[model samples]
Target: MSEQNKTWCPNIEFNETDEELILKAELPGVKIEDLIINAQTRFVSISGICNPDKSTDEKEVIPSQFNYGQIKCNTPLPVAIQPEKTRAEFIDGVLTISMPKLRVASAVNF
Candidate 1:
């Protein structure tokens, strides 16, 4: 199939703590340079491209279920976050993003 015609979705997990929110995405065979991440106060978006291995050999056709090409995911945060403080890392085909929650002061009555 043509590279432009293929599309795939990566598995993702989102979690939140009292101090921060965490997002994890499983992307096999995807390079770090091909990833793009955008974070806002209330949402996060991830996009990337995964290319299939190129081979120049004559072989018989076989049935396979591997996905390639563009991938995109947009998820809303459970709470307000500090997008400026967001941090991310990619390891072993897995991406982990950590975002600190925006702290709001509580009202006090004397």
Candidate 2:
């Protein structure tokens, strides 16, 4: 496939729980080394490369539906999170990211 044909962005899902925020991204055929994950206080971003199939011939391809090449997904959090405590894991073509919600300190009246 050509460079223009090989570029696509993956789809991501974001959810929030009582204690943490969760992210799930579809990243089939992507390797851990090719992935980059970035976390901030209120946002998280992920980029990765999905290698194209080398065994298939250009003529043999009928309908192309797969997403290949560099892919990126970014989303802003609904609430502030602790970026330092963020964690990510990739399993079975899915990437899962978990970030702990920041604890708000209450002011005490004198």
Candidate 3:
């Protein structure tokens, strides 16, 4: 399939702490160099490819369980964030992203 033709959505998990929002995505067999992340103040986008296993001998395939293809995940931030300081890490077939929550300014009346 062409690079632009094959696409899929990977599953994701979200967590929030007092300081930041954490996003974890399941991406088995995907390389770090193949990933592209785009973060905004209220949104984040992750895209990559999970290439099919070529090492396994081509037998009469009965059934395939793993979803292998172009994977993409787009998630909305619970609160505004400083996208410039966002951090992403890929380890053990999982992608974790931490986004610092923007602090709200308080108002005072005399």
Top candidate (TM-score): 3
Q: Give lDDT per model, in order.
A: 0.87, 0.84, 0.85
Better of 2 and 3 by lDDT: 3
Off by over 4 Å in 2: 1-7, 56-59
Best of the two (1, 3) by TM-score: 3
Top candidate, metric lDDT = 1
Please identify which of the two predictions, 1 or 2, would achieve the higher TM-score against the true structure: 1
- Cα TM-score of candidate 1: 0.86
> TM-scores across all candidates?
0.86, 0.85, 0.87
How do the residues 1-110 of candidate 2 rate in per-residue lDDT, one tens digit apiece?
A: 66434656678888888999999888988888899999999889887787766665556346557777677667888889999999999999999999999999999999
* Candidate 1 C-alpha lDDT tens digits along 5-61: 576668888888889899999987889999999999999998889877757684527
RMSD of each: 2.0, 2.2, 2.5
For candidate 2, report its TM-score. Answer: 0.85
lDDT of 2: 0.84
Look at candidate 3 and tell me the lDDT of residue 74: 82
Worst 10 residues of 3 by lDDT: 56-65
- Residue 19's C-alpha lDDT in candidate 3? 90
Rank all candidate structures by their lDDT, best first, as comma-separated numbers. Answer: 1, 3, 2
